[model samples]
Target: MWITYFFSSLLRFISVVFYGEITTDFKPCIEFFYAETIPQGISGDYQALCQHYENQYHFATLYDRNRRIPLFSAYILSPGDGPRPKNTNWMIEPRLVSDKVNTGMEYQKHPDQNVKNSQAVNEDYKHSGYTRGHLAPSGHQQTEEDKEATFTLTNIAPQMEKFNNGPWNNLEDEMAERFKVCTSKMYVITGVMPYEKDEPKINNRVTVPEYFWTAYCCPTFTAGPDQNYFPTYAAVGRNDPNSKDDIVKKNTQDGHDVKEMSLEDLEKILQNRLKMPEMSLFKNKCKE
Candidate 1:
């Protein structure tokens, strides 16, 4: 079976190189962003959200079909300067609605096997008292195309305005600065955790998250006194301002609560909450 699979893959590669197209009997939903790792045991239907520009994957997301939002978005940080793009237009993924929607064969299987069309649009946030939070922030992107790709609704979730503009924004800025100094590639994964009680939904469309979590791994960095901490870092921020200080303490002055911890510690918390004892965000925890 292994030999057959290997030759089949080889043939596909060769066909693509010569014919500019390759046919397959069965093709799995390819998750381009999970080159490092993908979380486990997330209920509800999920589809890989890939934003392609110029025949390349600009960024990827794990979109939740039921909730009409992204569970997480992953991207590699690139260095750039100057003001970021502001004219981003939020758009829905048509392929998520139907496989026949001409997405350049991005979805190989039936559309039902992919994300459902929950129709989460910009108007859903209107008068809903929530912000359109970006899991993969545009600020981290280097090119205009990459930055614009982050504007898709599939890459956003419902978040409190305070949390989105306050502590969460600060965390993203810090990450950008850190990535600028890293000697090697840095992979960042940002996601949200559902509320334990009274889960809120915006406009009866998008479910609001309780906590927003982020983790980054920089396998290579400049040697420093804190070299051990340079490789990886994890953090969780509170999205509900009124929620108790169980996971993340409330910071009244800052308008949001955020706590930084080790990647291992974050994984342990996720294991219990996500009910996946083997949940790993980074491949082998980004071990050297």
Candidate 2:
């Protein structure tokens, strides 16, 4: 047992060095971020990126080195009220800018090819027929700085305009409302699921996801009849209107179907889709 434990520890240490350490800013909130089984082939390059702004960690992103896009972003919803700040200018991650592992500038000249760097710039999304969807929404942020931190391209994905502006936007607003009523902090993880086959790419730079998912854990809340359901909630939204209803059925109001479910069910969907047999968004499923 001791030998096995030592090897496991060694392997984790090696992974950090190869993938780069989780940014210092995220150290305090690391427990809230979950572990994901990176898809095959990109294991060595997957990075745990902490979106830092003004010297503080606003959110955490699991970035794919091969796709040059974020797999997911995790953040804690702080207490806040009123309208969200205006959309800030998109910026490239400075950590990605400094990483040597993300070299290869050939794709910059060819927009049709996949970009294999750590950072994504505005040009990549221009005229891409998709909205720069936020994984960690600014509306959940309490401070202006935190809101601005969410504008980084690393925190965005190529989402259909209809989905981005419609149901998906509504889901974000609903989450903000839920967070407002919670007595304690809420930890949220939002991510995208890639298509099983024939994945679409925008500008041939970033892969477009087929579905968008979000799960939140509010460990502390005012006790009531809904206490059983109060601490955890999750939902998945279809990003592709053309796709069938195998994952989530489309709603009548809008083509972008958004379905809310328990956190466990959402984890099951993620496990099957991500090929991670034991995918848990919260530490020990956020049990007390």
Candidate 3:
């Protein structure tokens, strides 16, 4: 037992140094952030995830176990070399349910009582009229395992059908294209904004978000076509058609379109809408 434990610890350390996984810490997965920095001013009932899958760390997510959804997912933008994974074998993080469980994510099998009670499961989303939207979308991933890793329920939120398939997905495609031309690494953080009060839920479990938001900070980059902005950019899209046309406007398809803005402006909007006195998504807004 002791020998087995030693090797496991050794291997985990190697992963942290070489692959940039943060498995054991109060702030999990700092390696996923640029300059080892995390977003500030977020509080109230959340868990940070290293996003381990198939013995690898794919990204980072700040999960709300109470709401059974991710507040945000942060990852280094890859060139997205191949097609999206066809498999829908979504997964779950066992550590979220029990700290004693020491393993990477596992396939989302039948939801036992503890698993069902602790987090959202496949049944919670079955016929729930909402798609299992990914906070770190698979399309942004370069490898098959990383793409598959994004399917974990902990990194997912309940998204509207048209919104996910339409504007939101389109935004992802555009970001991918923009990232392809960049000469340096780009760190992207995608997240959702829940209603300030009496948030809605699906299957009485997973909380649905009112709006989806994403931002990227590229400290240094070679300019692509139609390029003027640098360092950081952001956008927010409406998940509800009935929402007011302020941050994002209505489109012809009876849905809201994505609106891009400066990273600083986006933080102010999040601070106001989420009711936090202050909010910052990146360290120095990625100035350094």
Provide the lDDT at 249 for model 1. 72
lDDT per residue as tens, model 1, 1-288: 999999999986665443222122112223332343444434334666566644567666776777787777878877466566665556667766765665621222233422334547777787998888999888888777677767777888988888899888998888887876688778888988887767789877688988899998888888765566668899999887776787777657654788998998888867676555356777667767
Worst 10 residues of 3 by lDDT: 17-26
- Per-residue error for 168 in candidate 2, Å, reads 1.1
Off by over 4 Å in 3: 1-28
After superposing all C-alphas onto the true structure, candidate 2 shows an RMSD in angstroms of 5.9
Model 1 residue pairs with clashes: none
The segments of candidate 2 whose C-alpha lies over 4 angstroms from its true place after superposition are 1-44, 79-84, 100-116, 224-228
Cα displacement (angstroms), candidate 1, residue 12, comes to: 23
Q: Choose the strongest candidate by lDDT.
A: 3
11 in model 3: Cα distance from truth in Å?
Answer: 32
Q: Count clashes in each candidate, considering only residues at least 3 apart in sequence or on different chains.
A: 0, 0, 0
The CA lDDT at 186 in model 1 is 82
Each prediction's RMSD over C-alphas, in Å, is: 8.0, 5.9, 7.5
lDDT of 2 at 280: 59
Looking at model 2, which ten-residue stretch has the lowest summed lDDT?
Answer: 35-44
